[model samples]
Structures are given as C-alpha cells and as structure tokens.
Target: MASIARRPDGKWRARYRDDDGKQHAKHFDRKGDAQKWLNEVTAAVVTGTYVDPNAGRLTLRDFYLEWKTRQVWAPTTLRAMDTAIRCCTFADTDLAKLRRSHVEQWVKTMTATLAASTIRTRVNNVRSVLRAAIRDRIIATDPSEAVTLPRQRRTEHAMRIPTPEQVGQVLTAAEDWFAPFVALAAFAGLRIGEASAVQVRDIDFLRRTLHVQRQVQNGPTGVEVSAPKYGSERKVYLPDALVTLLAQHIERVGVHGDDGWLFPGVPTSPRNMRRAFDRTCERVGLDLIPHDLRHFYASGLIAAGCDVVTVQRALGHAKATTTLNTYGHLWPTAEDRTRVAAADLMSTALDARGDQLGTAEG
Candidate 1:
C-alpha cells in the first residue's frame, strides 16, 4: 500500500513500503504528482522490478571499483581494463546521470589521439562496466550502447610470412640457446608466449606431438605462466627434423629432468629471448617479429595442401574464423583447383573417344 499527504513545507509527500519492508518517500510540488509517483512505485514493487533511487547515486569510479573486484580476468586483460578506467573522462560522473552524448563525446576525444583499435578496446571496456551497472539497476539504460567507434583498418605490413631461405638464414645466425625457440615457432606454429612456457615434460617423443597448455605473459607485476590465450590448449604435431634437433639439443644441454624448463633463464623465470631474436634478425638482414615465425609456419602448411581445419588446430586458434581472418589469403582457392579438374576431365573424355574410333576402324 502507499500513502500521500501534505507536508509542513507546502509540498506533497508520497511514501511506500518495499518488498523488504523498507520505507521510502519522495516529495513533489503537487498532490497529483505525489500520487502518481506512489502508484508507479507500488506497481514496480508488485512486479519485482523496483530499484532504490539512492543506490544509483554512486559515481562511475566508485561503481567500477566495486564491480572490478568481483570479476576474474586474465592478468593482461586486468591491466588493460585498469588502464581504460584510469583514462576514462566520466569516471567522476554519476552512474545514473550518464547519457549517450557523454559517451559520444568521449569517443570523439579518444579518436584524436589513440589508434582506432586502441579506442575500440578502451570504449568497450567502459561499455562493459556500464552494462554491469544496468544489471544491478544502477541505471535505467546503458548510455554506451550503439555508440559509434573509430573504424579499424587492416594493413598488409601487419602480418608477414618469411620465405624458407630467410628462415634458414635466421636459424643460422641465431645463438645456440635461442635457435630451438625459433624452430619451434617457425615449424610448430607456437606463439612466442607458448614457446617460452614449454616444459620438457610437454613433449611426447613417441607421438611426435607437443602439448600446448600454457603461455608466459608479462603483466604489470612481472612475468607469469598463464593458460594459453582463449584457453586454446591443443596438441601440435612435430616434424621429424624438428624432433631430431630437439633431441640433440636436449642431450647437449644436459637437461635430464622432465620438470626443467625447455628454455631456462634465471631462477623461476623463462628466458627473455626477444633480444636474441632481434639480434639474429638484424644479422640475417631481415625485419621480423618473433610472431612472424608462427605466420611462416601457417604459410608452409597452406602451401603443402593442408586444409583450413588442420591449420587451425596446428596454430591452436580458438576458432576457424580467426585462422581464416589472419591467414585466409594464403589458403588455396577452390576456383583454381576446379579449373584444373575440368581441363583434365575434358582431355580424358576426348582420349577415350579416340580409342573407341580406332578399335571400330580396325
């Protein structure tokens, strides 16, 4: 039930008790307005959608702090989200008062300085925070919804696959300790992080497969071993040559224990191999990132007539679409193969007709 009455200040006050027996009141200038507000609140309570107006007064920063504590994100993701929050313009604004214009303005401001991909990432982070606020009834609507973001442009130079000769040159120029790392990435399609985290126990000599279960990530705190990106734990087959090289390397390094890190550095850390990789690339007169080796591996698979699904599994991609988007250009087209097959079919038919004619004439 609800009640409306005149107050001492010449205002009408509406009062109601919620489902939990909590009393709430609001004052209006007119008795009709007070009555209308009371009716709306009572209906909302009966329908189980009532929200306490006072709860939404917290600023975005405060709400985000509360919301973030309850979330379980990967370390790298957590760092990115933290950066987004710290750099947001509306952090001090009230969650209830956020509007679409505010979000649009923020996007405009970010576009001036940040890359399109970076702006999208930061905006999405803020949008996710506000979405949680909506679920908690902190706001009636999400302001960040449908906000236009900067467009992302793909550049050809972003991903490059080196030729086999270039790969050979790089291997020849790399130090002995880092050569195996390059080989694993170039041949086995392992990301640099996954390659660095590989343990001796992860290799299956009999099956010639490497179990990719974890990756090394450098976070705000320090380097730590974490699950592979998107949990893409998969087994990638090893080439016979790579297997033999790994066996010889293991013997030479005198690493007898299965628990030892495949590429060991200081105590409790994987070796920082990027410096060595960069030096080797410079020596070999090639410009490449460590990840390019993984691209080279995919290109080789496609060149050797491997299907999309096989390449996807070899790369440990979470989705086939991801593999397609990254290396779709390298895959062979069905159109070309169809043309070749058509030509072969017509030639065979003509040859068979000639043979029948010769037999009939005889």
Candidate 2:
C-alpha cells in the first residue's frame, strides 16, 4: 500500500511497505511530488518489479570493505583507492543512506580546490563504488549517476607534451650509470615500475628488443616485482640509439647474468632508491613526473608521424582506441590526410545531388 500525508515539518511524505514486512517512507517538498513518487512506487509494487531504494541498509565502511576485498588490483592501486574513499564525505557515513547532494557537494568542493584530472579520478572512483553497489543489488538507483561532475579543465600542464629534443636533453644530462636507464624510459616509454624491474637477461641485444615481463613497486612489504602495470606483458622494441646505449651500458656496468636487474639498485638490490634514480631528477632540473617519460615515448611516436594503431601496439595497450584517446590530442595534422577530407568524399555526392548544377546557376 502507498499514500501521501503531511509530515510534522509541513512536507509531504510518501509511505509504503516492503514484502519483508517493513515500512518505507520517502519525503518530498510538495504534495504532487509525493503523489507522483507514490504512484510510481505503487505501480512498481503491483508488478513485483519495484526496487526498494532503501532495501539493504549498510554503512560506507561495510561497502568499502566489500569493494576493497573484491579488487584484484595492485597494492599501490588499492592504497590509492582506499585513500580516495577516505577523502569522501561519506567516508564515515552509512552507504545505504548516501545521498546525491552529498556527492554533488563533494564534487563541487573538490573541483574548486583540486586539479581536473584529480577531480575526474575521484569521480571515477565514486562511480566505481556505486557501480559495485548496483551490481551487488544493494541499491536500486545509483546516486552517483545524479551527481554532476566538473568539466576537465584543459590546463597548459595537461596539454604540454614533452618533445623529443627535451627528452634527449634530460636523458643526456643524467649520469652515465643512470643515462641508459633514463634513455630507456624516454625512448621505450616503459613505466618506472617496469624499468626498475627489468632484468639483464630481458635485453636481447641481438634482437634489439627488451622483454617487459614484470614491474617493481614499493609497498609496506618492501620492493616487490609484479607483472606489468596494465598486465598486458609484452616486449618493447629498442630504437637504434637506445639499443646502442644499452649494449655499452651492459659492457660498462657488467651484467650479473640473466637474473640480474638491468636497472638494479646500486647496492645489489632490485630497487636501490638510496642511489641511482633518487635525487637524479632533482639534479637534472626537469620538473616532471617520473611516469611522464612514458608520455615522452608516446609523444615522440606521435611526433615521428607514426600511425596511432602501431603506436598503440608498441605501447602494449589493450586497445588501439585507448592510445588514440589518451595521446591523440598530441598528434600533429598531416598534409597528406588533408587531401582525403570529407569534402573530397562528398565531391561525387555533391555532383549526384545537383549541387554542382546549382553552383553553375548561381
């Protein structure tokens, strides 16, 4: 049964009941609004397709635990998700009673303070959480869906892709020991995690390629070597310049057999943060993220006039569309492509449609 009645606060409230013998009530600002809600609820209840918006009352901490356990992501990824969840206003609230207003306010506050990419990531994370809730049948409606997120502000820093000349200069400035490593990242576009775990044996000098089988990451348990970041483990082709650099670096540093790390930490560790990479960036004067080298690799490929599909393959992306979406903006327009424009395709169509005849008449 369903009906609308005025509450003590002088607002209309829709009252209903679930099959499990529990009363459900939803408040509205107006009587008509309450009646509309009651109509929808009663119609749904009659058809047995009604989804109780407040069916399972669980806390945010409960869902967080559920979400966290279900994630098969890397530890670093888990930590980031946990941190993002903590930053939410509902971090300590009941997930079952989570409101759209709370999410909107959070987005607004964060958008005013945080970077666009950061805000986007937070929105995505919240979406992920609500998606899981819906999948679990815990919630009938996703509150995150109603929330309006901020537009991604295209800042100069966001669009400023690293040029090859700048990349070469930065790598060149690195010390001899770190030079080859930096060059590898700049040229090959391997993530720092992948580069750090690269074994000496992974480099097939004769083949002119490096096998990217795993990655090194920092965790509470210390440095751990795990599979590639995207988990699409694949080999990276070495440019002639980088290949030559690697060959020389191997000979100079003396590779410790196949098991030894190519970019091994100085004190014979998988990750030697105490030396090699640390302070090297500070020394070099490049105010860039370590992972930006991957961008440098993608940007260079785009700049060299390589096809987006091939670049996607070289980067081992799961999809060519992914590569196109991320780095397509950095690609320069080709004169050859202009020759095959939509206008050219429309040439015959325009002629067939008598547009040519109209042009002559005009």
Candidate 3:
C-alpha cells in the first residue's frame, strides 16, 4: 500500500514500496499531487512497468557518455557522434525531464546555424541517445520523434559524372601511377576509401574480379583501416580491358608480393590521391570529383540495362533502395517501353487482319 503525509516543511510527501520491497518517496507542494504520483507509481508497479525514479535523474550528457562507451561505432561514425554530442544544446537537461518542445527548439536553433542535412544528422544523433534512454526505461517516450526537419533538395549539379569518352580522356591525362586508381573508381565503382585499401591479392586477374573487403579512413586520431561502409564487402567484375590495364599497372609499380597495396605510398601506407585526381581532372578540362567516377561507373551499368540488384551489387550498396535513390533517374522508364511495345503489337495485328481480309476477298 502507498502512503501520503504532510511533511514538517509544509510539503506533501508520498511513499510506496515496490514489488521487490524497495521504498521510494517523492515530495509535492499539494496533497493531491502527491496522491496522483503515488497512484501512478503503484499502477506502474502492478503492471510490471515500474522504473526507478533515480535512474533518469542523470543529465543527457551523463547518459550519452555512458551509452557511447558501450557502442561499437566506425571511426567516421564515432567522429560524427562526438561532434553531435559536443554541439547539442541540451547537454545539461535531465534525460527524464526533456520534452518534445525542447527538441523542437533545438532543431530550430540548429537550423539557423547548420545546413539541412547536417541538422538532420545531428538531430538523429540526439534521437539515438534518447532512444537508448527509452530502451533502458529512463524515459517512456522519444521527444525527437515528432520534430520536423528541413527538406533536402536534390540538384543535378551536385554530382558530375563524366561520359565514357571523357573518362577515356581523363585516364589518358592521368600519370602512369595514377591511371590505375582512376580506372578502379570509374570501372570497378569502388569508393575512394575502398580503393585505397585494396591489396594486390584482393584482385583476381584470371577471374576478372575485384574484391572489396576493407576501407581506409582518416579519423581524429589518425589513419585507420576499417570495414567497408555498411559492411558491404562485395566482388565487382572487371572488363577485359580493365584487367589488362591492372596487369600492366602491377608490372609498372614492381609489386613483388601479393600483400603489398595495389597503390602504395610511404612504407606500409596508402597514398592520398585526391590532389592527383583533381589535377588530372583540371588538365582534361573535366569538372569532376573522385566520387563522380563512381557515379560514372553506376551510370554505365544502368545504361547497359543492368537491373537494380546488379547495380546495387556492383556499387557495393548495402540496399537496392540506395542504388535506386541515387541513380533512379538514369534508369529507362517502364512507361516509355510499354508504349513502344504496345505500338509494335497493334501494327502487327493490323497487318495480319488486312492479309486475312484480302485472302478471303480473293
């Protein structure tokens, strides 16, 4: 049974014992308020949903720190989360007391200072923390769930994919050592990180395949080799021309052992090839980023009538939806194909009908 009494300080006090015989107490200014709280606590206990009041007293910062330590995030993800936590405004707010309005206001403030995508990411980070809090029974509901975010516009100019002819030009303009790197990105559709982490052994020349198992990322501490994004380790097929070019590249680089990096820089490290790629692009009069080469590869696959699953696999996308979302515009419209097929069928039927009528008349 729960009990309520007026304290000497003129505040009403409520006390209750949980199923485990753990006593809990809360003070309120009015007896009715104390009774209400006690009743809620008793109901929760009866429903086996009782959460210790003290568990949620910790500030958001405190809970996040505790939660962060238990998570195994990738290096880039860890850096992003750290940045989000540092930039969040409600670090001092109690986890239990945090309200939807507080999250909405935070989103508003963030919108004023950050890009739409960035604000969305940071808000997601906060939401992740709150979600953990809910799972731990520190809070009953997520405050960030109902918060509205700004829309992100997709611009065609965001990605500049070079044509096949332009790709050839860029490859020709690149230096001997750098040509292979460009080819890997444009042909094999490897991310820059995945390309950098490639070992000679990872390529099977006879099989004409490139295996992507890992990636190189530069984090706050330093360069680190980690799993590929979304754990999308996949094998991408290579054309005969690309395979021959890769063989020539290996010979030119004098890679004696299979363990050596396909594109090595300093002793036991991969080269940073961004500047070289940029210089080559400028020389060839093409406005392109290293990632645009990947887009070019996907475009080629799509143009060749590759299905969404094939394109997704070739690009090492974790989800087919991701491939569609990025390159859906490049796919041939089913409506257009349907119209053409319908016309051909109608024409054939009319010709057959006319021949039958002429034969019957004869």
Candidate 4:
C-alpha cells in the first residue's frame, strides 16, 4: 500500500511498503509531487517491474561476486567469465545509476585493441551481471541491453584452413612423439585438448575409430582433466592410414594398456602441445597452429562432399549451425547445383525434340 500524507513540518510524505513488508518513504515539497511518486511506484508494482529503492546501491562487482557463486560454469567458461569480470571497467558503478553510456564507452575503449568477438563476449558477461540484478529486483532495467557492440565477421572467411600438402608436410616434419598429436588434429578433427587427453583405450584399431570422452583444460587454478566440451563427446571414424599410424605410434611409444596415454611423458596441456606444434611448423617452414590442422580436416570433409550435419558430427561440434557458420563457404552452393541440373534436363529435352523433327522431315 502507498499513501501521500501532509507531514507536521509542512512537507508532503509519500510512503509505500514493498512486497517484503519493508516500508520506504520520500519527502516532497508539494502534495502533487508526493502523489506522483506513489503513482509511479504503484504502476511499477502492478507491472511486476518494481525494484527495491535501496537495493540498487550495490555496485556491479559486488553483485558479480554473489552471482558467480550460483553459476555452474565449466572450467574454461569459468576462466573466461572471470577474465571478463576483471576486465570490466565500470564494475564499481552502482547498478541503479549505471547508464547505457557507461557500457557504450567501455565497448568503445575495447574496440581499439580487442577483436569484435572478444569484445562481444566481455560485453555479454557484463550484461549477464546486469540481468541478474534485474531479476533480484535491484535494478529496474539493464543498462547494457541497448548498448551497441562491434560486429563479428563470419568465421568461414576468418578461419585459416591449411592445404592437404601442408598438413602432410607438418605431419612428416613433426618429431616422433608429436606426429600422432598432429595426426589426431589434422586427420580426426580433435581439438588440441581432446587430442591431448586421448588414451590407448579410447582408440579402437579393429573398428578404426577414436572415442572422445575427456579433455585437458586450463582452469583458474591450472591444467586439469575434465569432460570434453558440451556435446563434444563422440566417436570419430578413422581412415585406414590414420589407424595404421596410431598403431605404429603405440608400438613405438611402448604403450600397451588402455590406460596408457597416447603421448606419454608429454604434458597433456594445450600450451605444451602448441609449443611442440610450433616447433614442427618451423621445421616444415609452415606458419600454422594445431587448430589450423582441424580446419584442414574439416575442409577435407567438405571437399569430399560431406553434408553440414556429417561435418558437424565428424568435428564434434555442439550444433550443425556451428559447422555451417565456420565452413559454410566451403560447401558448394545449392543455386549452382540447381542451375547445372536445369541445364542438363533442358539439353536432353532439346536433343530429343531435334531428333523427332529430323525424323518427321525425312
């Protein structure tokens, strides 16, 4: 309930009790101003957009600290969220007073040095914090909601896909221990982390397949073994050549049991893997990372007439749209196929018509 009353000091007092039974009051010079304030509060309550008058005094960082504990983020995601929170410059600003200009300015500052996608992630992180505050009834609206963000380019053009020859050269030039690592990425389309976590038991020589179940990830603390990326746990078919290579690699490394790591003695971390991969690239005179090999594998699939869903499953992408977003350009255009099909049909019909006309004339 809300009411406007004339105070003993010749001022008007507008008072209301919130849903929680706590009362709030504002002193105004005129009775009209007091009633207007009550009307606004009553409308906000009716519309289910009411916020506690004093709750929004907490800063963004304060809310983030409380909000983070409730999130069930994966290790990589946790690290990324922490990074975004730390990087947010307006974390000290009060949620109620935080304006869209503040978010826009923060985005503008990031545009100078950060990529569009990176900036977008950071902005989204801050926005999530604001959205939580809204849900908690600390703020009425999200300041970051309407702020403009930098545009991210389509991945198909941005991704660097290495050629088959370059992939072969890298595989050949890689050191004995690292060759299998490169092969898994280039041939099987495993992420560096997933490849690093591959154990002997995960490989099936008879079926020529690799099971992806776990990954080595870098969390806030350090490197840790964890489940593969969401929807990334899958079985990937191996080519006969790749299967033979793995068998030889296992024998050479003296790996016997299912529990044995494929790259024994090497740290199962992306940093170590990248270091080894960089060395191999230098030896082969190619400028490429292990991830480029994954692109190489995906491009090979697309070139061999694999559909979007087929490539998505092969690469263990969580969604087919992710596959299409990154490699859609590699797929042949439907319009091109349609035009060819129409031309062939028209040509056959015309040829038959010409033969009939010639026979009639004869």
Among all candidates shown, the one with the greatest TM-score:
4
Please write out the lDDT profile of model 4 over residues 261-359, one tens digit for every residue.
887543366778889999989987988988898998999998898989999999999999988888888888989789989999999999999999999
Answer with 1 or 2, whichever has the higher TM-score: 1
lDDT for each residue of candidate 3 in 290-340, tens digit (9 for 90 to 100): 898999999999888899999999898889988888988888788978998
Better of 1 and 2 by lDDT: 1
Sorting all predicted structures by lDDT, with the top scorer first, yields: 4, 3, 1, 2
* lDDT against true structure, model 4: 0.88
Cα lDDT tens digits, model 1, 56-113, are: 7899889988889999898888888889989888888988788899999888998888
- Candidates' C-alpha lDDT: 0.84, 0.73, 0.84, 0.88
TM-score of 4: 0.90
What does each candidate score in C-alpha RMSD? 3.7, 8.9, 3.7, 3.0
The parts of candidate 4 lying over 4 Å away from their true place are: 219-221, 256-258, 346-362
Error of 4 at 334 (Å): 2.6
TM-score of each: 0.82, 0.73, 0.84, 0.90
Most accurate candidate by lDDT: 4
Q: How many residue pairs clash in model 3? A: 0
Between prediction 1 and prediction 3, the one with superior TM-score is: 3
Worst 10 residues of 2 by lDDT: 266-275
Minimal lDDT window, size 10, model 4: 256-265
